[model samples]
Target: MKNKIGILALLLLSQVCFSQLLTRKLIHGQVVNDSINVENVVVFNANSKTGTVTSSQGFFSINVRENDTLVFSGLQFKSKKYVYSDIKGIDLKIKLEIFTHQLSEVVVSNKNNIKPIQGSQSIVDKKYFDDEKSSSKNRTMMQVGGVENPMDFVRMYKDVFKILKKKYPKKTDFTTQTDFTEIVMKKIGYSFFTNKLKLNDDAIKLFLVYCENESKARMFSKSTTEFELMDFLIVKNMEFKKITAINK
Candidate 1:
């Protein structure tokens, strides 16, 4: 009886040590919409060796091995990736972003001669950030434009283009943020256009990726890991620049 009790105590101690040991990590992040917390967004481990979804409170806890890569995915949102070393615990906030999808037609129209729109482009300004200011995790300022909702911007741009076409009634090449600014600037003799912008697969693909990153960052921020990501655009890089000036 004494031997059995001693063995049981050792087993219990071993279990406690295993749970407390940080051999693996618990990955977590909150999924919120507008200001309200959204629950039950699916989160999967990207490494494929292990994976799990979030809980009802927009939080998820997944056990990850050392050096494992984590991938968080959801509906109508971009998927985000992170490393095991980057996530500390299961307390973090994630903000999801939406994508825009528009189809332009190529047909003969007597009213106006608008060219067919082809290809998708994304312009990411190569930003140089200034000195960092110390702030709380929740107090950090997020650009309302990028974080608020991108779908609205897409609609507003589309409407403006429609108005411009109606007013000019010409086949002027329609250019906006939809095209690479570097390509446009190269034609216009501006070298600052060397900023990083690439033709993403499509708007949905881009938005999904953005949302995933944003959400992952939110959760990753709560972790003890340190990140070397670029600073927010609004901090020091927020400014309106022309993508292209259409010709009549």
Candidate 2:
């Protein structure tokens, strides 16, 4: 009877241990904000002493257990703390307020404005048309109405080209593939791909790369609204699932 009781006690202890292990799983979370860039925000788990920085899309995953405290801090945002109660779902959405700096009042004065010296005589140097003529002779062919000559016409065109180049320079797109992907992911969230679209992490990444191949995806970076981008993603996601045969 004592051996039987000991075996039952061991089983109960193992069950509790297993439950604790299940509670200590990786929790997916996001630092959500409309006005600020949520990337690089630090999320510190006080209990475990482990932390993770938010992605460009403001998403982060951290190992959390029951009753663990998560602290979120960033340069631009106010620090916030959240306790893991398991009351909320596995996915945590933390909204942080922007930190505003209070500035002291500044005063400007023009009280000591400079005044011209009293009774100062102004001197002027007189110049004749000879100086103007000498200066005119040093002027370039384009400035001297020499455009009628073929060589002068070439010089004139070169000058015009330089001006045009300065006025309207070629625009270079510094936006990289990673940057574009982040922008799309930020506008449309990770949950959209994971939950609604039923895409696994690897499949979601591949689907994004597939979408990036589309010409319309580049346009989504610019003036396209979130709704428009979501619509585009939905269509592409269907095509992606069809091609990859990813039912989930």
Q: Best-fitting candidate, measured by TM-score?
A: 2
Model 2: per-residue Cα lDDT over 12-131, one tens digit each: 999999898666788798898879778656676667756666778888888788889887766567668899977887899999898787789875778787544665422111224556
Candidate 1 lDDT, 26-140, residue by residue in tens: 6555665664445434554555444444455666666666567766555555456666554454565666654447669665668665544454222231234544565423437
* Error of model 2, residue 140, in angstroms: 81
Per lDDT, the best of the predicted structures is 2
What is the TM-score of each predicted model, taking all chains together?
0.30, 0.38
**Poorest 10 consecutive residues by lDDT, candidate 1:** 239-248
Model 2's alpha-carbon lDDT is: 0.71
Clashes of each: 2, 0
On the 0 to 100 scale, the lDDT of residue 196 in model 1 is 30
lDDT of each: 0.45, 0.71
